[model samples]
Target: MRPTSLEGLPPTDNTEALEPQRTAPARSVVRGFMYAALGLGMMILFAGLAWSIRGGMEPPSTELETAPQTNVVSAPDPQIVSFKKGRLAYQVHCTRCHGPEGRGDGPDAMALRPPPRDFATRPWSHGETPEAIRAVIRQGIPGTAMTGWSELLSPQELDAVVDYVGTLGPLPSQNTEASDARKALLRRAGFEPVEPTIAASPLTFEGLDGRKQTLDQEQGKAILLIFWGTTCAPCMDELPSLDQVAKEFADAPLAVLPICVDEPDDELVREVARTRTKHLPLFVDRTGLARIQYDVQTLPCAVLIDPEGRQVGRLQGGKDWSSETVQTLLRTITSQATDLK
Candidate 1:
């Protein structure tokens, strides 16, 4: 017998009892939708806030500009006894100004007054003996950019530089008369055993646009002339920083000329100009005329020429043009030019 409600008239349907269960699932779905919407709203709000903060910030004027100052360490007894060690040391410290081959015609050699000493030449003024060369490296020549490296390099490193230098030229011979005569000649020429200034010669090259450009045309403006070549590994390394510098001073009255010393065809030159450099004006010295004019003996060098057509500064090897020191130097040059006008 089926059970019937005690007080009601009709029997209730069993489905009616399941109605709350169905409604409960619906409520749960609604809550889940609400939670999703709230999460999405929070994400949007954070994104907007971040965008606003970013917009309010200023663009940085410099990038990785400052380098930490290093403390000077006294050199220990030289442990670099091998020629290989000396060669490596020379490459690290002397390659920029002295050149990789110790030719004394490093890229920056042209800008230095009296120029660097040609290791291959006879009669080294500082003496060809390893000890003499080491002394010069430790003491540095007066009135020149060659600062004493005693504080910067270890004794082993100094020995290495000396050893490397000796390999480039003949060592001091028993005959002292020739060396003495060479020294006397240098003194007579007012070099004081070392010249104080080297004049920068004018250079001419074909621009990417087929325009014939000469250093003389840039006399009225300060010139930042970069001598580089494809064969030079160091020169290739410096290109990116050089491009940054070119862009930085685009508006200034300074001519940034990056002359390639490679002998490439017009199409190749155009390709290199378009791809390698960032729209920086490119020039080619196919005949090596420009290199000869500047007396560039090394790869990857820069010359800062004043309006008077005088080379005021020079940098050799790979340089960080983005550095604060480099920027300050450029600014100072610009300011001086303005004052003169």
Candidate 2:
């Protein structure tokens, strides 16, 4: 007879059917877990690749840190006092009385008795040489609205204005014989005539490689001597551009020497040269003898010496050495030296 319970039934074809029903759901769950694990592994691999690509696009941290501190200081052209600077100075200081073009018909000129000097007329009561004009700018006229600008402007600014004034009129020819005679008379009377340019004193210093050097050794070549210090912010700011100028004249007979007005330390100078100016040759003045000899009272000054060992000119402050105007000036100087040879 057919039994109600499995124990009383004969286990034959129905036994296999019961086994398949119990194990089917467990197999489906195992397959689902394996698929989920594979998807997670693929996501991790893609994330790693994206991170590497972004890291490769950026520069190193050291390069980024030193880039901004390279060179940012820029002054007016040092070779010639620039007219652009002169015009700006005139607008600020002389526009009210002398007018824009220096016609002497400004708003304040009408109220004055003697009136501002008419630069267009070229009838200067004082002398018309650059020296005379510079003197007037520094000392002012005895009876005029013009005040002494020695306190207001730098020597370079005064020179720029003088050059601008000459553009407005035909400057008188300089009387060299008379000037010499006057200077001689003053010397006889126990007075000294003020010289327009100061001569550079002799300099001797040690190089970064621990070799002794002297300015006399560079006599046959035009030398660009830069006085800088590690502690000076402006000096550091001007170094990179100066190095670029040196590179441009690598084949020329120009000696670009950056003299450090600090204690002599080969390692320190080398480090500074490597990071700040890669191509520049460095010299150190341990006793400040070079600074005293060159009369460098300011940081970031440059002294240009001709092939004859005479100082051509001196720039008293920082300048943009890589500017087009500065590059032209250096080229002219180098060309002149080549012509002499």
Top-TM-score structure, candidate number: 2
Question: Can you give the TM-score per candidate against the true fold?
Answer: 0.42, 0.43
Compared with the true structure, the alpha-carbon lDDT of candidate 2 equals 0.71
Clashes of each: 5, 0
Best by lDDT: 2
Residue 135 local lDDT, model 1:
85
Q: Which stretches of model 2 miss by more than 4 angstroms?
A: 1-199
- Report residue 228 deviation for candidate 1 (angstroms): 0.8
lDDT of predicted model 1: 0.67
Candidate 2 structure quality by residue, lDDT tens digits, 1-341 = 66778885556887776987879988989989999999999899999999899889877778777776422222322322255567678889887898876778887999997899877664587987889989898999887778889998887788788776766553332267854754454344332343322223456666766566777777667888899887788888888998898788999979998988864666776776677787778887755556655667888778776564545556767777887656765675576578778
Please, what are the lDDT tens digits per residue for candidate 1 over residues 1-341? 65565665443887976888899999999999999999999999999999889867956435533544232222221332244567677777777887876678787888998788877677787787778988888999998867788897777667666665665664333246744653453333222221212223545677765566777677667788888876777876777777888888888778889888765455665664465578478887654556655557777777766555555456567776777666766665565567567
**lDDT score for residue 265 of model 2:** 65
